[model samples]
Target: MIPATETPVCEAAGVRVVRAGRALLDDVSIALHAGELLAVLGPNGAGKSTLLGALTGDLSPDAGDVRFAGRPLKDWGLGELSRRRGVLLQDTATSFPFTVREVVEMGRAPWRRTARAAEDEEAVDAAIAAADIAHLSGRRVPSLSGGERARTAFARVVAGRTGALFLDEPTAALDLGHQEDLLRLARDRARAGDAVLIILHDLNLAAAYADRVILLQNGRIVAAGGPDEAFTAETLSAVYRTPVEVIPHPVTGRGIVLPLRG
Candidate 1:
């Protein structure tokens, strides 16, 4: 649990979003604290991305409020908000050919007024290294593989050095090893006093890394709390409409959820 003395970096209260006569999100409230990784999990059309969008200011809630550092999101100007939060979107595609280094360097645009040349280069270098893309720095983004492009996008976000990270299906393109690496890096960032709100489809990954979980279904928050609490067999089977089993991992004692194949 987040300590009572600490302030949440971002928070939502009764946030709702509507589109095309459907409530994509409904009265969802959650808090994101520094040094913690909070996972939003649900089946497709469950509004996981909508919730992420609402929290990140990409989409405004039709009702209720989203606050950043105690103030409403509307009050936080776009320029400053962009600097305080970094978003790793579901896609980072570009038709124009840009070197990986160039793409990563673009993250510094928000801080250009205050950043020195040396500082910008250092940050970009560190981010590239952190994303394990040092070897691909000179490669054009359009020329890279899907997983490589995803890493470059992550590098761009990490280069921004935002206090809060909003990752939407960040591991969608990676192989097993890279998937583990990316999640571990997110864990590392959280340990360094960064607030991470990640949208994950894989229940096991959420169980392994998230400090807490928010389970959404049909635009409502079905559960919110620790992995063990949020991802019980009953809840999973109900929300996902599938038979599932939640068992303890052999070594870590964390919940290991698996779908029961017929």
Candidate 2:
């Protein structure tokens, strides 16, 4: 993990990946800047998750470099990396009978040897509250609903205090209200100077919350810019292989992406 005083930045440069015989990712590069929410969006098979995996240090690129806070990802010790950034995957299921608090406290594992145990506990409590899972504190992880479990996973990341957050499809299992809640939390995190990168299938959610959007197609970034520039009708139609329209939100005036019916 980068020191607390440092601005966490994760970047991939000229990244390439091949599985079996075919190329999965080709020369894709991006940088996650501190205090901004960068959303990665694309159609299925677009390699969105693959790019995320590489950026998070879970996957190694065949060619190119990935850096975390100015250090090569491979050079960072696991313990230190865990302390500097937290990753929330798309599927956060656990069959273990651990309680919500227990699962949340697991985030503090890396910091356990430090003298800041009390501070860790305080952060855990705050994360629980922030996730709105405080009422389910004593409940077992296996017994909670999908949305609740997702929230618990989010709380774990929040408690980690890592200057960066990488979330993959966090809103997939959430209800409408919870979906908004999660994205809003991402906005809040970025505002607090954390480098936040989220992979989202919902373009509207990305349009509403992300300060920047990266549109990927067939394992490459086709567009990278603000929502208005990244999500035009022509780009969406071509990349998604379907016709669509982009119009301003009736009230907010931000771009709203919607599909066109046959």
TM-score for each model = 0.96, 0.95
Candidate 1 local lDDT, 32-113, one digit each (tens):
9998999999999999999888888889889989999888888989889988999988977866899999999998888877
Clash count for each candidate, listed in order shown: 0, 2
Instruction: List candidate 2 segments past 4 Å from native.
Output: 1-8
lDDT, model 1, position 190: 95
lDDT per residue, candidate 2, 130-236, as tens digits?
Answer: 88899999999999999999999999998998889999998998899989988998899999989999999999999999999999998999999889988999999
Pairs in clash, predicted candidate 1: none
Flag regions of model 1 displaced more than 4 Å: 115-118
Residue-level lDDT for 106 in candidate 1: 91
